[model samples]
Target: MHSLRNTRLPFKVSLSLLSLSLILPIQTSGLLFKPLTLPPSHPLSLQSYQPLTSATTTTTITTNNTTPSPLTLSTNMTLFYPAETAPHKATILGFPSTHAVPRDLLNQTRNEIMDLAVVISEFEPVRVHVRPEDESLARRILNERFQKLEDINNNNNNNNNNRTKKAKAKRFNLLNRRTRDNNSKEDDIPQYHLDRITFHPCPTNHPWVRDTAPVYVLDKSNPAHRIAIDFGFCEWGGKNLREINVRNEPLGLEADGEDERSPVSSRKGYAAPDNRHWENARFAKRVLEREFDLDEQAENNEIKVERVVSPLRLEGGALEVDGEGTFLATESSIICPHRNPSSSLTTREAIESHLRALLGVTKIIWFPGRKGLDITDCHVDGEVKFIEPGLVVQNKPHPKTGKAEMEIYKEIKEILGRETDAQGRKIRVVELEAADPDLVGWGGDYDEGGEEELEKEQEEAAGTYVNFYFVNGGLIVPAFGDQKRDRKAVETLRGLISPERKIRQVYVSALPLMGGVVHCVTQQVI
Candidate 1:
């Protein structure tokens, strides 16, 4: 169990004195004595009292550099989140665990997982805990989720609810079948069954854990301290083709005329597929508990993990903070019309408020982002990161290829130059060129269904290197196999990081097909 203690001490200040009598020049003043007619005092009352005066005055002085002989302050520390200096803490990762990716990609992801596990274990004992839907908490969350889904279904159903008897029967049968299947699974599945995996059964199935997972932060003033910031995530703000994008096509949908089953009907369908969200949450909880060394009985049996929810929907990928007080973010994702249409907070206001409340931060440095582009609009991490206080590493636009994006980069540089932190410290921006542009097709297909479809496809096809993830002791930078640019990127990052931190490259060829990269797939918990 964690223990607490206190200490106390005293300090003294030095004093100096000088005599005014010795420093002043001699002066003579008239001395006169006058006695008015008064009654004579008795011998006992005639004693004289002298007035008090000081020729010398003492001055007490304090210096900023003066070292106090003894001082006391409580120091409480924990290794819950791995320090950048420490090589042992495993970097938590949120992968694009989509089933649509090629089988080889899955194998590679598995390998990467094992590699990360080994690295973390070498530093300290590691436990891989997947998130499980807490049945106790399920009722509340499920009720809320079901309400939302029902609203959407009802809205879509519109006035069809009061249709003729025959039509009502058909709809009833379909609804009844779905309901029965769901009920059976719920009854058969044991709450405590360790083997069972559950998915977040929300209709907005953009279950990308990295985009939605809570960002954990430690409170410097408190002992046994940690907090989770839930960043709001959208479905990449509707970048991919809603229906035709094969990579993004929902699971359980089969060919036109096959014996395909709805996910609701399959035992392993939805549960096994979207387990990443639950897994991440569970892993995060365990890490916090173990790191703080809380009393097992009290923490496990009594105290629940406390969370501070930020209404401002921010994904960790969109935010990059220096270990210090400053954070870097872009205006695009935070303020995009696509993410929050009715939000009262503007881009600047939302950022300032969010930083102050969530990060205990006073200032947020913003760069005018590439707007009206792909998903996430433009996450700040794709543009710049705070490598250290007052210093940044930015993704430079390619001079020859990204002509338009280069203009955006120039604007970003200008903005960064004018901005300062809350402490009035100027930010130093560094530039690194973006990866080479690939020949991407609209939704990875040559044909466009219509003029509107063509425009949408073009927007989704733009390739970006800004979406990169920084892993534990390494950077999982995305590479599109453009040899020249890829090599330069690797070299640029290696120069900034230490030799101990490996620069591992992950080739995400399939990202452009759906319109994002590695950073989109992972969110870092600070």
Candidate 2:
């Protein structure tokens, strides 16, 4: 563990941060967290072993394909961060088994993810990860979905061809008539690119890749170089405890099925049958190693992957970064004692220092995230997202949750309005309205769960459209069943994004039922 070096911050900048340190002060009083005592049985503590092996000890395996072999990093790897709107090499997504998920809503969630993958493929390459047994199921769904889309496109293309032929025959008429373009009308509409999407076998505990998967970054020393940041994840502050406990039972065999488990599940992070939460993190790294290896080999085999390991227990969803230097996060998720105990991070300065070194952030804005409001402890991804360097998009409060839940949004907007970006430009905030109540409870009734589980679904069903991903030339956004609100969201996004970007929307009602939306399941490689 000592072999993995901590990244050093620049001397001049370190002095600057020390002199201009800013704390939450009285503005975030109740949010000030105290250290927590870890349960005796809990595997996580300040000194607990990391979920994955030391970077130096990571195994190197060669695939039969032309791809480069997975490499290891004994020292810290400084990574180059890219803005969310930057061009992406590819996007990674995951799908859970129907057995692991509630059977009643399995089809809904599966179709939503499939639809999301298909739509995103139209813009940039997409990779869908599934458990080994579910690989065929994923392929079948995507194939059938794309085939239908292809048939429609073919029919439309035939009609367009006929129109073009008729116009071509009358050369003088074509000159008199507005010169018709040869391209089909569907050219304006993004057609699904089946070739752009590839399915891979990657067994995961859940489908939320944004949290568990390795965050991609470029090497600062070499722009062509790529790095994978394996920041340790503890299953969203150990919210997976219930799921892990249930899986340890005998009846659990019937619930999730034995086929879903991966060989990586036997690692140190998953040694304890009672808490298999960290298994997701371990398996995610394995999947990313393969992705990085293949992508690098396909581009430049000389460029090797540099792995960076961090001991911090945080989820990618908890913090939002504008590729430049500004970072947005909630105190309850990162600064909270539950995730970053004093024994580990020690002080706010120490925590911020870690973030600055790892994320290359200059300023971190902290908000008092409502504790227990959602599983992620009010992750900023749900409330705030950066469209560009100085432009931000925030979620509107749910109609059912009312104004009380909206106070946070108002506070954040007010503060951001006064703040400036790395280039010293005042932030421009855009508000994305909430989903209608009628669409909130669309899929909750199908699941026969306990009152507590049902209540959680009700609270999360109407997730805002703010949680969206920015691809190369397009925006992948969530579309709730509410016809009016969905269209409004697309219109609002068009106003916020540049006119050149293609906006693609998918019906993602099932995501809210599981406590996340579009952005939660996708992570882009820069």
Question: How many residue pairs clash in all the candidates, one count each?
Answer: 4, 1
Give the alpha-carbon lDDT of every model: 0.38, 0.57
* Candidate 2 clashing pairs, residues 3+ apart or interchain: 80-218
Q: Can you write out model 2's per-residue Cα lDDT over 307-384, one digit (the tens) per residue?
A: 454545577787688888888887767875454332435356657766776676787888787664556667888888
Q: Ten residues in a row with the worst lDDT in model 2?
A: 1-10
Off by over 4 Å in 2: 1-78, 149-186, 243-278, 296-303, 402-404, 441-460
> Can you tell me which runs of candidate 1 are displaced by over 4 Å?
1-90, 94-207, 236-241, 244-304, 341-343, 400-403, 422-425, 439-467
Taking all chains together, the TM-score of candidate 1 against the true structure is 0.52
Candidate 1: 10-residue stretch with minimal lDDT: 1-10
Best by TM-score: 2
How would you encode candidate 1's per-residue C-alpha lDDT over 181-232 as one tens digit per residue? Answer: 2112322211111112122222122223445555666556653454554443
Candidate 1, number of clashes: 4
List TM-score per model, in order.
0.52, 0.72
lDDT of 1 at 149: 33
